[model samples]
Target chain A: MNDIYLDNNATTKCDPLVVEAMLPFFTEQFGNPSSLHSFGNKVGLALKNARKSVQKLIGAEHDSEIIFTSCGSESDSTAIMSALKAQPNRTEIITTVVEHPAVLNLCEYLETEGYTIHKLKVDGKGNLDMDEYKSLLSDNVAIVSVMWANNETGTIFPVEEMAELADEAGVVFHTDAVQAVGKLPIDLENSAIHMLSISGHKLHAPKGVGVLYLKRGVRFRPLLRGGHQERGRRAGTENVASIVGLGVAAELALQNMEHENTVVKAMRDRLQEGILAAVPNAFVTGNPDNRLPNTANIAFEYIEGEAILLLMNKMGIAASSGSACTSGSLEPSHVMKAMGIPYTAAHGTVRFSLSRYNTMEEVERVIEAVPPIVAKLRKLSPYWGESGPVENPEQAFAPVYA
Target chain B: MWDYSETVKEHFYNPKNAGAIEEANAVGDVGSISCGDALRLTLKVEPETEIILDAGFQTFGCGSAIASSSALTEMVKGKTLDEALKISNQDIADFLDGLPPEKMHCSVMGREALQAAVANYRGEEWVDDHEEGALVCKCFAIDEVMIRDTIRENNLSSVQDVTNYTKAGGGCSSCHEGIENILMEEMQARGETFMPGAIQKKKAKPAAQPLVTLETPEPAAAPAAGGMSAFQRYKKIEEVIEKVRPNLQADRGDCELLDIDGKNIYVSLVGACSGCQMAAMTVGGIQQKMIEALGEFVKIIPVDKAQYAAQLAQKQATASA
Candidate 1:
């Protein structure tokens, strides 16, 4: 049996159809899309069709609004940079605490460049503080880049409503929908969002391809300045094959949205319930009410995450951890820490992010395997059955930060 | 994934003498949940000889930490408390072949647990005594003495090296400047020139968010190493690599040093060697000769051409930014 991979939030295997669609671009149709030759015209036409496919997936009005880039990081950086450059008078940037490194690192760099970066806090359940988000939106705010859905917990933020608020404030809003693009329904035609980021690999497309949905008439600047590719909005040679692959993957994502919402979500819930039911001191980390269908971030208290992952690896189960030991930076995930997850469980958080590829059989295998693994690791832990871990996990962190 | 050695995996999977010893006379505990790893080591000590009759441990940490604790328990049996105290963090790692540099803190936790247990047996108050110097790294509970000792012992050049060895500057990194001063102090004491801007230059990627809070800050179970300083080894490696370079340069190839971990020598092939079909063979030949000339078992890990280029580009971007 192959390893039961539940780390789709990291990256997904490319759909065979997507790979097949990409192959022609690498060989016969390999031409610079920007060139004025017949070879270039054919490639350019293919790129336009791919952009249209992406446009339909995101429910955008025009295909011209879609700008293909290398990956999600570049798309996010470009969108934020464009917004900031378009409005130099507004030096303030508002973002969330639990953003992926793509957004957070860029904001950090911007902060060093004398930008006032207001990183808004989240609730104990990993929900954004709406009141704070409302209060922070003001005339001086240059751009507000909030992720549509968190990569870790899959907690889908209310970006639509946030975008409405930003629009009312006359601010340029960008949602990093890298995790949400294909999974959730997005209608940029009706929404007030100026820009959104999407990564191909997050949804059965190959890596090294991404899309930035720029709302029409939004002032922008190119992140990479070279060739007039991506309609002069983005520079450099287009990644022809991956861009074609991304288009097909985007279409497949739309088709598989139903299965993702039902079957995959069912498996995720089963895995979450199965682990929480069997393992003592285990609890779900984020808000379960409005979360993505695929992610189940459960914190198994009293034991560390890396040990559990190692044991699970032996059983052909692949998952990720939020433990400080697992992260090379020697800190538990900033998301979990931000949610104020207790120290005992914080060090032992396991993230099982599912995909349409996962099955109930694989889910069962995980359920059957995880409990014993946690039990074994807990035996070695001094905190287990001791006064170390709090009985009520929610009460772990007493003083809630404002 | 952490490239844990076979011995570490064995010790971690089938831990020895886990759990509290009821008849144990002395007990030592270090680290806390906040720090992500902790150990409570119990020892049955003979009063007359101060020898450990039996040793057991209950560790709350990652694989390497548990394995280190298990290995520590196995190693301390029938050995005097003083003798066990002499067993440094590096010694535990040596027993387990060698742990990944990231997991070195696990071995350090083991050594500290031993010290705490021994101090407990000798009727000494060590838990408080361990916090002797001014606190340098608040997030990791790393004191000035601990940072200085680690820098002096390891001959650490930069804050990153300090982090790898003692986990002093791994956290929020607000104390990197504090660690930098210690590194500067220790390096100058040895008459070695230290790059003062090394720590300050490698800025933290992003500051911690408003939501994330350090609720509990734990102690520094992290200890220093015992060996020929990294500076001395770096010079020896440079001299050794220079010996092997002429042969490679003759073939229109060259290697650039990336990093020098204890047994792991990271280098990137440049010139003709970058995409040569016989690059691995060349690397192997160089490794064999360098080991003989340097009189040390060093694995020369060649960073792939693509990765080397990406790293160089990122470094340039950072410098230019």
Candidate 2:
């Protein structure tokens, strides 16, 4: 375990209670839900209960609305692929550039197969361009898949409004709510979103399990086809243990949503403010007023993000970076590039995502450790002089990339 | 998360020469904030002997970049300007116990900084730009010459290898075809061929001839500091051989370095490489690396392992007499 972990957006620690709930399913109660025997019937009853737990957590009208998949990526792929397969005539997709690669990469692949993919741009604050988004919507579009909260910046898109607009255009809407499922209050029963995706691991459940909340009346097609599991909506024998763990995690998420918005959010805000106060040429990198309560992306100009992350790791702090080096590319993130963030700050962005388990003490330790590391790196920066931080990186070093 | 070596980690934590020298006579800076890594290398050269007295570095990059810069500064100190110019990016990686392939570009950055610093001391012009129509990977702004040089230096066989060393085709991947053409061109020039999905399939024309018209030949008068000089060209063969040594060793194969005479290099492929069919590819790769290293092409003269051993014994006897 790290002394301080601020990478909840990547993955969270599995809750012990959720692990305990999964243990029985893995050991003694390992019968297949498909069998007609008493052992199978008992497991089927547990499966139904887990589905109901997920339904209550997301405020779905029926337990059957939640279809279990392997992970968030699988859920996202199913949602987007099902929408396009359900309607063959609509050969276009409308999405945002700031979407997680699960959606963006799929859309790009679909483009090669003759589907017109319109990727909406984002502003400097990581907010989607609403006018372009509105203009791109049409009956020709099969689906509009945008992330509810960006995994990198935590900037929440107006997915609800977009979903309603897509609905009016006679299109299915899917939002990759992998980051927003537990942190925010979601009422899928009363929402216009045709489908929503969730990952169990993001909310302190075991990995390899996810929920695809398909509205009761929405037309659907399964991405996987093997067994009659999930009412022929999804396939393969269920990941029974992980599904049980996910159910407990969902219940816990419902219980902790209030604490997440207040306590965890306060710690995140303090860590953001403290780092900014001590470091120069640094600023938050999202729609600060309307983002996830737990995520804060801070960019410090001139110095690169990977260096900062390594130094912080040395100090027993775990975090993440938006730099290209982290992603095994020669350029920064697609989200940072799409936002047109200045070159100086874009490559230097660091993301800190908090969980309800984090505390003010860990936040304070991070605040104290960051300032000195930044100063030390600045002193070693070629672009940084004794005076002020580098204002324009492009001027000092030519030939930059997006 | 990056599988960095202990030496790299030590250098990152306690970088030997981490700051700038106020009155340094020679200074060379490469990369920019926009490029995601930058380095400013300062050197104090002893004027009459042209020997480096001291060195310092300020690097803005990842941990490996910092470690590479630190290793470069240490390696160059006390060496003459001529000797310093011979240090390849591979030498920097070797000094720090080798870097991951993905982080190999950091060592390349260090080599560029050293060249700039040496050129600065000699009052020669150094460049950061490519000529018009020379850019290959536009997203990273890496040009054709740099890509070719890196492919040769690292024995890179694919677009992914090129990106790992020089970051040329690691962008939007539009230039992947351009890089593949270059790879094919370089491979054919050395007579090495593979048949991975028609990648190494021979064309009807002279195989050595470039298949694509997109690549512009390296300019006759290459940029002073940015381009390879005679020393760098001469050193490249040894570096190329050294770079492939471990891979050969891994398979219980090896090569004995004997002599270099103009366009012909004499070597005895030993161990598993002695009479193996795949050694043909290794020989082709060595020649290909040299062809790109120096603008002119070279060939390898395969001396049998037994014959070379006899020749070495005869030479030793003659020296004693």
Candidate 3:
């Protein structure tokens, strides 16, 4: 069986069209965009066109506002550090508890460096408490870095409204829109969002490429200082091939966003419905409708996420769990913890993020393979004391087990 | 990502005896939820023969722990009581084609669950000297008799010696006092009584004598350092060393009492400790502090590189000529 991948939020396989667009940069159009030769000008014009494409996707007024970085984490670090540099006197930062570690860890490092940070709490539904957010906002606040949508929970935040509030408070607003862009419509022209971060690998583009949207009048210091690359904003040799790939991906996503909302969501909902019906003690872990249409996180009580992943690996079904990182710390996710999920349930969190390429047939196949695996782990789990078996372990596999 | 043997994965995926027997003649539960793993086992016996009729298990743990418990259930299903009671953790792992070294504790859990289940069947309870034995460290499934035997055999003379040998007093300091009490009792029983104030005399003198000999001389002079005034520092050092000796014996190594001025310990690493990279980590991480805490008056030292290199060179020159 070909493995079914449902971790698009973690990283995505590059689309074939994006790969095709990147080929010329590797073979025929290889040149330093900043060089004086004609070959350099040709590639430089290609880079310019790619920048224009990315600018159109986010609805940026000028192409010069976009700065390409290595990845979303780099973008986050650059934005936060630059904001602090721009307003050194303002030593306060306000962010939500559910921000990705890329933003959260940087915020923590900043706090240790004398920046006062206020982490707004999240409700059980994983939505940030806006009242506390408003209460914490002041002129001393340097920046409010909120994610457009949670990578783990997929709970969409009100970034526009928050940006407007930050504008009124004279605080810079940045959103890590790595999960939102390409899947959702982003109209930066109408919003007060001064800085936004988006990654390529998140939207079926190549890895090692990301875009940071800085408004034309925004003043920020450079995180990577060396050469005058990215017009002296970001310093690094251009990842020409991957940038081309990201440009194509952004164009495809702009064309496919509406269809993803409708078609992809239907498949995601069907998969969620089937999983809920087939397995006991399994429930979705985010806001049902407010979540990204392509994403669903579920917690299976009494069983750990690693054990479930082990079982899923046997059946050639690929998914991600929030239990253990490569570091082997068995701590539950901070995102889940911020939502007040108990460690037992929190460690069992598994994320299933679909893509435009995912199908209803694959969803059905997942539903067919999941019940027995969950049942087996539940039997050995001590949390659910002797609850017998789930309602039907053999429903999906009557012939084999019987 | 581990290169698990196919058989190990098979047993883990489809463990033979997994579930609970509705009406069981025996039941046992080991570990608690806070420790992150537990096992509940149930067994049924044939009325006439007392042979295990069926065995089933429920484990709240990682895959290996559950699989080990399930393996134990299968190992004892058809055995008589005495035969089943003799099964060790190694037996479970050997049956499952050898487990990873770190996961040996899983097999230990398997052995504990089976024993606990059988004891539950026979309605046996923990006792001071009931022969069936008492739980050693509830966190790691160690027992009292095992600790005593390890201490006596290894010649471990301190609380740290017992920890290195039996992994007791390794977690949650709540249990270290129990280990200390057990060590004291065992030492007293062996005619090595506690002493106070011998530490001041030892500090005053500058000769190298065996620490165990110094500790065993008198009980009154040793325990002068604290509210428990009879526990002498040198005596505690001897007690810890005596316990650790037999443990080193299992691996063909030996522990020696050290004498140093700036520090309380300075011992030669004769065999296995001479070359191992983790020798210092093992010593500094566990042994050094354990010995220091129990025996405050003596400094401990493993042989440094300069001394070890000279010894190696002398041996090499002797061999070459």
Candidate 4:
């Protein structure tokens, strides 16, 4: 059986060209960039060129602004903590309730340490409340951190405008753009975003490499303080090969940016439209217009997501879910919960995130495979009846054991 | 991915008795969609011998849950109600060559549904005895009696084991303290003196205090050493901050207690601490010390100079009003 992978948001397959660019760094060109030798000069020059490539991909004004880290979480942690360290008198953090766990969990931890956290709410369509977000921006706020796009629902946030507002307030702003980096068009030179984070793995680069872009003149405190690296903004010996791979991936992403918006998006829409038409009572979860081009989150009501995923797995079709059972948590995804999605729909949400490598045939194969799985699982569900699904899905399936 | 047993996979793929019996005499349904799993079990019993003539189940859950329900129907058929009642969650698991530890709750769900079916057969309400006890794990709606009973029956040793067996402390884990309390109580009943932390030791001290009433006031007086009046907790909180002061001072920082309102410990960081990024760590250290010296009820509020001044002025206004 052929594997049809649609879980690209989880991680993308490393491009072979990126692998070819990185192979020489492992054994042949293996030299520490900080070493004062001819070998070091070659590696150091490669690092500089790679930085420029990444800088161009995101439209950053200068290459020096990009600080490479191990992963997206590290970049997120460094950015948020740096803002707090830069302005210690400010004990408040403004963020969204639907942010990835990297930002949400850290903010929660800070809350326990006496920092007041204002988690802005989201509407049913997964759009942030700008009025509430503006109201929370006070002089005491150290930073306003929000994700450029939601990982689960793929809903793009209005970070450009939000960042400008924060800039006007003289407050630091950071965005975890891990999902948005290669999927959307970002012009950091034109935006007021003080910092942005990107994971290499999200854009066909190898894992264990990330980039934190801090605008020059933005006061930053290093999370990892040691011998000067990332121009003293970050520390540790650079991941040479992975960084090279990330650079090549970034360049490739920039080259294929239009294809992603055109061909890849068409495939995503076809799969989404096909699933919705074939599967009854199914609907898309996020905003139809303001979403990532290569992503779609669709909810198949009444049945649980894990069952659907297992049936899909049997057919060698890969996907992901926001269901509580899928995560082994009592509640579904925080993004779904923040949007106030009904439990019936929330428990059955499936996310199909595509990449540049995915073909129309693969999307068609998944569309053909998913409807039957949903229909089969819905048949097994007690809440689903012969006439139709029960009204008030929550109370209709109340616990009979207790 | 789950490493399900071959038996489990077979039963899941080809579930036996996968639908409801139309003329079923007794029906027992358990769990819910919100709980991430649910089962509807129907049984047809022979009126003369009281033997289970047929069993059918409709399950809405994961692979393990469906397999467990399928395995359950196969295990209960052709057995008397008394014999079916003797079938533990372990038996259902054993029939399927055992389930993953984390999926043990699926088997437990099957067992509970069976018990409910038997109760329905006997014309009795499936009144769960465990529900009467105080609720402990709010995330899973698990109660104290359920935690205690599962701990004793399964020989559960830690919170993780309790979670695997009953899913109690499996969610947000705010009820870990309550679960630990029940664990300690059960362990003490078994003549096991070992406890998890100093909080249990503190709890054990109160139980041993009735023997020496005169000595009780002396030890209690130490916690409230400065005075036994309204400001005693405040003075103690200040003392705890004094302990953490040197660590902060080493980093060119310092902390001062601004005010104490109820359990809230209002404090302000000064000098390098005022703009230090590690201020969260410094405040956390002070909060930990306060919890150790005072109690868990202390809520530390780190304020800046302006916020501290506003709070002080507000306190004065409220006092006058």
- TM-score, chain A, candidate 1: 0.95
lDDT of 1 by residue, A178-206 (tens): 88977888899999999999999999999
- The DockQ of predicted model 2 stands at 0.25
Q: Can you write out model 3's per-residue Cα lDDT over A1-402, one digit (the tens) per residue? A: 578988899899999999998998998889999898988989888889889999989999889999999999999999989999988899998888888889998898777678899988888888877888898889899899999999987899999999998988888999999999988898898889999999999998999999999988887999999999999999888999999899899999999999889999999889889998988777888677698989889988766776677788889888888663211333467787788776556667788999988888889999898888888788775445456534443231111000
Off by over 4 Å in 1: A386-402, B127-321
For candidate 2, lDDT tens digit of each residue in A311-392? Answer: 9998999999988778666678888888888766788899999998898999999999999988888888877878675556
Q: Report residue A204 deviation for candidate 1 (angstroms).
A: 0.7
* Top of the candidates by DockQ: 4
TM-score quality measure for candidate 3: 0.68
TM-score of each: 0.76, 0.78, 0.68, 0.76
Model 2 residue B151 lDDT score: 77
Clashes of 1: 0
Better of 1 and 3 by TM-score: 1
Could you give candidate 2's per-residue lDDT for residues B1-321 as a string of tens digits? 888989999998889988888779999878645557778899999999999999999887888988999999999999999999989776787789877756776887888888888888889978754332356876556778888777777777877588657657655678887788788777776687623474444334322444454855443342322245646755776787777677677647787667765556788787666654346666876676656545555688779867777887998799799
Q: Where is the poorest 10-residue window by lDDT in model 3 chain B?
A: B197-206
What local distance difference test score does each model get? 0.83, 0.83, 0.76, 0.84
Model 2 captures what fraction of native contacts?
0.50
Sorted on lDDT, highest at the top, how do the candidates line up? 4, 2, 1, 3
Q: Write the per-residue lDDT of candidate 4 for residues B1-321, one digit (tens) a residue.
A: 777899998988778888788889878888756657888889999988889999998777888888999999999999999999999776787788777655767888899999998889899989654454666765455778878889899867677578756757865667776677677778888878546654434521222223344653432243432224546666677788887677677646788888776556788898666644345655765675677675444677789878779877997799799
DockQ for every prediction shown: 0.22, 0.25, 0.11, 0.27
**DockQ of candidate 3, scored on C-alphas against the true complex (2 decimals):** 0.11
